[model samples]
Target: MIEERGRVLSVEAGAVWVETVRTSTCGSCAAKAGCGQALLSRVGSGAKRGFIRALTDRQWQIGDEVFIGIPEDAVVRGALWVYMVPLLGLFASALLAQAAGVAEPGMIGAALLGLAAGFAVVRWHGQRAQRDPQMMPQVLRSAGQVMPFAPEGRLNG
Candidate 1:
């Protein structure tokens, strides 16, 4: 499970709205100084607040701090779906156009069309996945409770 700490912003039927500070591991990344992402983070004040609605059965109050978690496999599958679909579409359509002896411009156009089709597929899948309980993040526990084990490399205070 991947987890983050957030404060409850609101409560609703079977869910809670959470506000969290967005954090990055850019400081320890090998390509920290070379990547555009790292540069963009440096330009900003470093911590930005983001809001997300997490599913939970337990009642929570507005000021409560909690831990939210999502399964690691869900994240990996999402990344693969988002990236591979478009790339495969581009290659497959371009190959088909070449085999059919289409002109160079026609092949390029086909590739572009295939890429758009791929994006359409991704959007469709995302809408469907939103209703899948396994794909949604959940409220794990209250942050104020003592952890069974201290996090790696950190000692309990």
Candidate 2:
């Protein structure tokens, strides 16, 4: 589970919207003196607001701090589909063409076609999954305590 502290901004039905702080690691960069990221960081200090939703069953009071967790299964399943499908498709297409006596150039074309098809499939699946409520992450609030996802002093409140 990945945990972070955030303040509740709004609650509607079964979801609570919370704002979390943003952080960056450009401060320690050896090229800070010459880097664009460092220049932006110096100018703005890099704090930003992000909203997260907690299920309605969870109780959250306005201005309250809460901890959130992202489930492990969600992480693993997402990884497998994103990385595995394309490679498998390319390999299968190449092997099939070779076995069928296709010329080298033709086989290469087939492999490229397979890779493109695989990427398309993965992208389509991801978009569909995002729209499905059952595929959304399950969020749980911490024990009546607000935890700052990013360090304090970053938010206006």
Candidate 3:
């Protein structure tokens, strides 16, 4: 299970909206100086405050802290959907366009068209997954279990 700490922004029926600072493990690691995630952290200084609605059984009040959990399988699947599908689409479309004896410009256009098609499929899949509980993140534990807040200086720069 992948876990994150967030503060409840609001509570509604069956779920709560949570706000969290986006951080990777490497961001807090002692050896961060050599970590790629640390490098990304340094570069991703502008990463926005992320918000998500998480299903929770426990009653929570505004600004209450909670831990959010997402399954590893779900994370892997999401990553593939976001990165791999478009790549495959680009290659497949280019090959198909070439097989059709299209000119170079046409081939480029076809590849781009394929990329769009892939993104379209991803969008459709995302809509469907919205209703799938297995893909959704859930409230895991209280703030006591996880750190209530991230390191302060880390967030600003």
Which ten contiguous residues of candidate 1 have the minimum total lDDT? 146-155
- Tell me which of candidates 1 and 2 scores higher on lDDT: 1
Predicted model with the maximum TM-score: 1
Q: Write the per-residue lDDT of candidate 2 for residues 44-133, one digit (tens) a residue.
A: 844566777755476566667776556677777778888889888899999999999999999999899889988999999999978765
In what order do the candidates fall by lDDT, top score first? 1, 3, 2
Flag clash pairs in model 2: 5-147, 5-148, 5-149, 14-56, 65-145, 65-146, 66-146
Best by lDDT: 1
- In order, candidate lDDTs are 0.87, 0.73, 0.84
Per-model TM-score versus the true fold: 0.86, 0.64, 0.77
Q: How much lDDT does candidate 2 score?
A: 0.73
Lowest lDDT 10-residue stretch of candidate 2: 148-157
Instruction: Point out where model 3 deviates above 4 Å.
Output: 24-48, 145-157
Worst 10 residues of 3 by lDDT: 148-157
Stretches > 4 Å off in candidate 2: 22-49, 131-134, 143-154
